[model samples]
Target: MDRNTVEKRVRELNDLLNDYGHAYYVLDRPIVPDSVYDQHMQELLSIEAEHPDLIFPDSPTQRVGGEILAGFSKVVHEFPMLSLSNVFNEEDIRDFDRRVQAGAGHSITYICELKIDGLAVSLKYENGRFIQGSTRGDGTIGEEITANLKTIRAIPLKLTEPITIEVRGEAYMPKKTFMKLNEARDENGEEPFANPRNAAAGSLRQLDPKIAASRNLSVFIYGIGGDGSAYGQDSHSDSLDYLASLGFETNKQSKRCKTIDEVIDFIESWQARRQDLDYEIDGIVIKVDGYEDQEQLGFTAKSPRWATAYKFPAEEVHTKLLDIELSVGRTGVVTPTAILEPVRVAGTTVARASLHNEDLIREKDIRIGDAVIIRKAGDIIPEVVSVLVEQRTGDEMPYHMPDNCPVCDSELIRIEGEVALRCVNPQCPAQMKEALIHFVSRNAMNIEGIGERVVDQLYTSGLVHDVADLYCLTKEQLLSLERMGEKSATNLLTAIEASKANSLEKLLFGLGIRHVGEKAAHILSEEFSTMDEIAKADAEKLTSIHEIGEKVADAVITFFNNEDVLEVLAKLKSYGVNMDYKGRTRQEIPTEGPFAGKTVVLTGKLTILTRNEAKEQIEALGGKVSGSVSKKTDLVIAGEEAGSKLVKAQELGITVWNETELVDALGEKE
Candidate 1:
């Protein structure tokens, strides 16, 4: 085929696929069958592969094709993405209404929208083509995530009409999608996300666009970035309609109410029916409809006075506490869990809840066989809200934490300045089991085919006593275990062998040293470049590094001093485990730069360079960029619309530099 003919066909295919995708994903109406869509998508993919030069940015095949990003850059919003003040009850709602009326000096129409339980994002378009997308990092600044956002089919790459705009939305995962994702995670021996909101956020923040695409996320565009009147719309409702007409997925459930009474009724109606929806809604957002009224009511430093959110009260259920169970963690901390009679709360069955510690148990006066009110904290963790002492019978037994470790029979000791009891014995079986599990976890060694259950089986069968024992496993031994087929045994051994090549940071994190988390592990690995260097460092040398405190230094010294730990290290070394940091080394901070050893705070909007670029430049010149202004702050770089941080810097007598001054200083350093 001729180039012109092929180009025409490609254009036709792009249009058809975009239209079909919009109908199916955004409007929830499929204009064509799944087979037809797949056929066209496959054709597009083949054509794009054949003629890479002809591939357009908005091509159907271009949605998820990008190299994994090292990190997200900062984006300053053209207009601030303000938050809404919260209204908990009817009284607060009525108070908001009164304030709006008093501020506007007239009656007002209101728009009520479902508050989607997901991440807030901003989408920017130039000439009706999607240009950039970002997160709501701080209202003023956000992280760029255009590649990840493009994977969401609900977000149109091109608008119906060519016009420049910036809109805000909530990106979310449907309940069905969330369940499927958790099931996949379970099968892969990965930790399941706590809620759909977290799943959505995690998916969007992925460095790889293909990962986000696989998660099947969607977005609901709620409002424009600035004012709706600029788009020739008089009110918020009208603006939503305009957005829908422009191929944005605006929520259709939003209602225009003439009175606060109608708004209250709408809120109450959704509060009961929220569970029936496919997605999660934490609350209802109430906003004054007319732009004039909203402008008149104005905004506070944090949120708009014309709008407020009515958060749904957490669902509480009463259940009988059957018994308290204890578990030991990798760090030997003893945790108490409450086994409860099965009861539904927040659309899930509650069989157990964490008691946190003995102090909480005694303070709440919790007893076995007592009726307790339970609720999901932030719609995720189930916790005991209160105990119904009046409903409790005399047969109820008082619960007390055991004095010894249940699994190892070791005496438990309460560490000074800590709440929970700990088993100091490093040889505790429970601790070893937990450590094995952590060693193979996603953020650590990342050995697939090994989960909590597999760890338990390995420990019980005496096949693995420590993490090092995992490297010595044989396929024959694995196949001897129940439900372990030959193929499964081979896969587990392969994964264990593969993990030996991981960088030093992964191994450090897997070791589960006290006060050493993933971030700390990475920092230590980068600073020392090798495990041996880290082990050889003294507390003074360790504490000299930024973000490393005396506590972490002490913990590192103690961990390296242990003979058992040294033996494990020698075994790992003998097994060919890599101990060198393989990741990119951070730039060294110069000691002789103009801003050397200075703590600088950047506030407001930067016009010359992005916030991230400024931060990098500052750090490159041996200056540390802090998020907030304090007495410790040596300098403040104030830009356009500098707010509280600027004022605080002035009040604290800190040296302040405007954008021009900052540019000059950077230029001098260069």
Candidate 2:
């Protein structure tokens, strides 16, 4: 128990764990069962907790468990991981070949590789040992992911040669791992990721390396990083061999093509043969053979001129549509899903397909009992292809979306110029649960470990009927839930507590209003920093804000004026959640000025600043935000709901700003 003794034990444990980690992760062999590994890890954690000085910076325990970070730490790539420009058609390919041929003179060979649909990463080695790994952020700098990258066995710890070098490659989840992830998400009641690329991005971006390690990520090294030191190579294909011999896992399917025809052959072969693999391959990468040729062709600021990616078409399968069922979204928007007879496509069984909106359904003439073709759009989600009416049965049912909310029975209302019909009920159970979840999501309250299944459990148990009820949960309440232990309960509570301190903008987006979205919420947040201010503001007052057109203004006023809605907000306020934030309180602040370290969204038309200018100004200020109003939204700049976002902001009382106001504010801030 003494520090002196603990340090020795810690050293021993770190060595043991690191070796075992290497065996299990890098070698794909383990000398101990996971139980034993867990026991050892627990002992190490206990020892480290007892004597903090005993934990090493590179300890294995540091990789898997830790507090989620606010953002990823940036690392400058010693050699940039450049993006390949895309060549969509055969003419583009010939054009690329023409350029390469002109650059290298007479004849030019190419290296063709399957475009692994995942994030690009770079690994650096010094004195034969892996030193750092980073993402391809902006091609110049990326987030440091050494701990996560170390978990992949394909990534070598030590190179065969003692040369200091960097390797570029794709980090992907196996189709099998992606399956498990989807299953796990479904089991947890969380929305499944759209594709394996998303799964890899989410997993690898985790602040906790342990979470990344659990995802079973793999890597395939493709290019050798160019250091100023490599004065020797005349072409790019030669570098591939140098990297291949240096203990890196390069692609086996890569080909050295002497002509564009060969490149086309490689592309067509992979297009047909991609199904035989256990992973997803979206396209093919064609690169000029020589580094000299690549340089002669030169680079655009964003992509290399010598290389191009040719994407494959999505995989489609013809099958019989058995029935049509409508699944209600969290917003009470009923989406029609085609429940088809089971058909295999894209390495998994497909039984259901998205019908998009009613308009799309009508346009496609899709119906129950119709023969249809299904495709994994981009090899990700299932969608219906053209219906084979040539084989339709007389028993086929013509589908119609319900006019009322299935769960809340609220009359569905579609906004002007919008295709979606939505329930306006704030108290709707389905909406409430989904809203609460959105509120606590990473973009909103960002409560860690609180996923969809856990949200479902709270709602099902009646412990959480609304957003305010989540704050009322105690350790005992959480621990009593399935799979929630004491430590988990404490952590969940801590995350929830932390979320309460988030800026008002996030809260506004998470409220699940019909029309308000992220951009509108940002606008609203800056206009009324406090929920009280927004709640008290009338439709006219709301509309007075820039971009708050009549449609959006009316929706906002309707949401706040509801009695039940007022009650919920009052309860949430009483529960100690901050209904106000500092960002929105100042009118003199920039409408478009970089809300440095703050997130903002723009919706509708801005009278003061153009949309692009507003976005640019925000980015310039070091503030980051995106489209789609969700819990993650920091502010919404609304010219109008332009749709659901306007209503959402009013319900949540997020700040609203007109385009002119935003443009003027942004200019003034700088």
Candidate 3:
């Protein structure tokens, strides 16, 4: 076919596919058969492959995802994405209604929407074409995740009409998809996500857009970014309708309540029937319908007064406490898990609940074989609420935590100021296995193919023990393991080799140090510049660096001083692992700047700069930006409507500077 004919065919295919996708994914009404969709999709893919130049940005084939991102860039939201205040009980909901009525000076219509338990995101469009999508990071700033968002078929690449706008929504995973994901993770020996919300959030945050696409995430656009009036909408319900009309997915379950009583009834009905839904909803969001009324109500420092969320009470069920099992974590803390008789709670079957520690078990007087009342905290983690003493018989046996490690049989020791007993034996098999899993995790050494199951296989097979032993893995040894194919084994080894080139911070974080987290690892790497320097530094010198507290210092000292850790380090060095910091060195940071060597705390909202930008600027000038104001804070950069942190700074007599002063100090003109 000629170029013009090919172009026409491409356009025709795009329109047809997009319409079919919208009808199926967004509307949940399939307009075409699976075979028909696949045939069209294959034709489009073949055409795009043949004529790459003809592929449009909003082509249906682009939803498959493109290249992997190195990292997400920070995006400053044009308008802040404020959270809504929560109302728990009936009284709280009534009080919220009273407050809204008093603020508006009249009766109000409330638009009640399901408070989807997922990651909140802002989607931006220019001339009706999707431009960017981001998280609701601290309201004012977020990470750019446009590629991931584009992969979500429910999110329209182009609107029905050409218009520039920004909309807020909740990106979520369906319960069925979440269950499948967890099952896959379980099979792969990877940690399962706590809930559908976490799965959605985790999927979106992945650097690879393909991962997000595979997760089958969907979005429910709730409102416009700034105001509905800008779009010629008079009320929130109208905005929802307009959004839906624009090819956006808006929840159809949302109701326009004329009175607060109706709103309460809606919430009550949902609280009872929530389990029947395909996705998770934590609460019901009640918003004043009129834009004029919302303008009058305005917003507080954190949340909008015009709207509030009514959180559902946690669902509880009574189950027999069959037994209690203990597991040792990477840090050697033994956690107790209550094995309960299978019972359904919060839409999932609950077979086990976290008992937290020995103290919790004793405090609640929980015993094996006793009838216990349990509930899912935050609709995720199952916990024992109370023992049903009335239902319990004298046959129930009291439970006690063992003094020795169940796996290694080492005598457990309880440290001062700590409640849980720890297995101090560094050679404990359970600890070693957990540490190996942590070492290969995404944030650590990032050996992608090595999961918990692989670690267990290697450990049990006696081919690996410590993190350093991973470097010694042979392809022959891997091939001997169950489910290990030649290609997967080769890929695993390649990943392991690639990990050897990672900077010092990755190794430090992967070492499973007691209190040294990712941030602390980065800080230590930056301060010391080399693992050797960090190892040589005493506790006093380590603690002198800002953000490296005594706890981290002690942990570092303890880690380096250990003979076993030293042997592991030696082996790792022999494997030619990179030990130097790859990020900006300490010398690159301005040593004689205005904020040099000062511990600064940022408070409130800055109109000019986002929080991350300000924090980065402060760090560049050798200033440590802390999250909270304390005695150690030498300066507080207070912006518009600074709250309790500002008050605390004033009480501590710390020097305070406004945003203008901060900019001026940094030698930048406003």
Candidate 4:
């Protein structure tokens, strides 16, 4: 095709793709299937590659994030992102309404919106094309996050008409995404995020755009950045409609109320049903609708007088702490749970709450028979917030954690650098049960039809004693268990049999070793081809590998040195379990290269490869990658906006190379 034909086709494709994207993302409606969209996108990408000069700033292809950034640059907002005044109760709402009425000398209309629990962001557009996005930093200046903002599919790259505008919105992660992220983090041996709001904030602040993209962030535009009159908008509600018309995602739940009483009703309705929504909301924002009314109301020094936020009262209840019960985990960590008097909290009847550990109990000074304030953390897990000291009576008894395991009467010991007490007894029935559950978990051996209920029944019936004994179950034995029929028993046996062929990493994790997690298991399995080899490795050998620290190495060595572990390994081998590591790690890695046998520290961020992807390639070529900079570092791979690690490398006189140099050394063509 000629240049003219290519240009015409590109324009057509862009229009079609943008419409489809807006429908799917902003509108939550898709006109075409994903496959159809992908096909058209492929055509667009091919044409753009062939004619790079024809690529426009708002091209759909630009959404696929390009480079990793070392750091975010600062952005100054054209208009100050003012905060709203807050109201706590019905009296405060009535007072605010009275003030507005007195100032205007007439009745007024109010717009109520759900105040989303998320990070605030400002998006700027020029000529109907998205030009930049920034965080709400100190209201005047913010960090540039254009690349990260682009990853949010709800954010449109181009508007419906060629109009310049700046909009403010809340960027948030949905509850489902937050749960999945925490689950993955737990499996990877990383600390779990406390709540969805924190997760969203951390994700948006990530220097790497790909990291932010993977977080599944979404946004809901609430208001224009500056004066609405410039856009020919008369009211806050009208501006919201205008934003929606421009293909921006706006909260449809926002309602225009004629009086403060209607606003109170709206707030009460949401407070009753807020949990039903997929996102979290901490409050309701009430704004005087008309721009003229807002100006007349004017601004207080720190907040807008025309707008106020009503924070929902936290759901908390007073309950007596009856007793503390202990439960042991698969890894032998014994956790204390508080037995509480039955009470209602956040629509659920609560009788128990996690104490976390003894430290929390001591910090709160909780006592048996004392009244404690309990609330659900993140509206999910019930926990004791604090003790109501004034409610304590003379009969209250100070609580103390048991020095022995509650299940087996074995002495408990606190491991070094750990907060919880552990029962090291290998024969503890509670540990055995927890280990069995972990063995069949989705992230472990992935054995289906074997849940905690089945594990409990099997343990109680004397059919399974340890992890190795799972393969020894018979059809008759399984059929005897409660709720187990012929079909279910057959399925359970099949799943158990299938798990025997899992890779060495799964089996290693299933064994319930102390400090070795799924990631460490994978690394050890890759370094050593067989289970016996890993078992035979000394602490020094384990510590020499990348990402394996002294504590983990010692834990691995201590676990494998046990006679009971040897017996279990032998039993598993006899049961036909695959003891050899079968993974792509070894076969895919090149043995010799310029990076081979070198310790590389990748600092800042690379433009091309993500941190994980770069680590894989380096490890594949026999190079070891460390997380931090040290004197032992052989080379530091620096990218744009390199930080302390790069400075440290220079101070230490260590070699440093930019991303291009590393790419050249790897013999890869640009």
Worst 10 residues of 1 by lDDT: 584-593
lDDT string for model 2 (66-126, tens) is: 5555667789875567777777668888887887787666688788888998889988887
Deviation (Å) of 203 in candidate 3? 12
Error of 3 at 600 (Å): 17
Q: Judged by TM-score, which candidate is best?
A: 3
Rank by TM-score (best first) = 3, 1, 2, 4
Residue-level lDDT for 422 in candidate 2: 76
Off by over 4 Å in 3: 1-114, 118-128, 131-154, 159-168, 172-218, 222-280, 284-311, 591-670
Candidate 3 residue-wise lDDT, 1-670, digit = tens: 9999999999888888988999999998998998998899899889999999989877888887789999999999977899888788999999998998898888999999999999999999989889899999878889999999998999998889987789999999999999999999999999888789889999999998899989999999999987665565668899999999999999999999999889989999999999899999999999999876776677775688999888888889999999999999999999999999999887678999999999999999999999999998867689999999888769999999998999999999999999999999888999999999999997899898988888999999999988999999999999999999999999999999999999999999999898888878988998999989999999789988978899989999989999999999999999988999998887677677678898887777788888778888888788987645556778989988777668867888989999999988877421
For each candidate, the alpha-carbon lDDT, in order, equals 0.89, 0.76, 0.89, 0.87
Model 1: how far residue 175 lies from native, Å: 8.7
Off by over 4 Å in 4: 317-370, 374-670
Better of 3 and 4 by lDDT: 3
Task: Count backbone overlaps in model 3.
Answer: 0
Clashes in model 3: which pairs?
none
The residue-level lDDT of candidate 2 at 578 comes to: 79
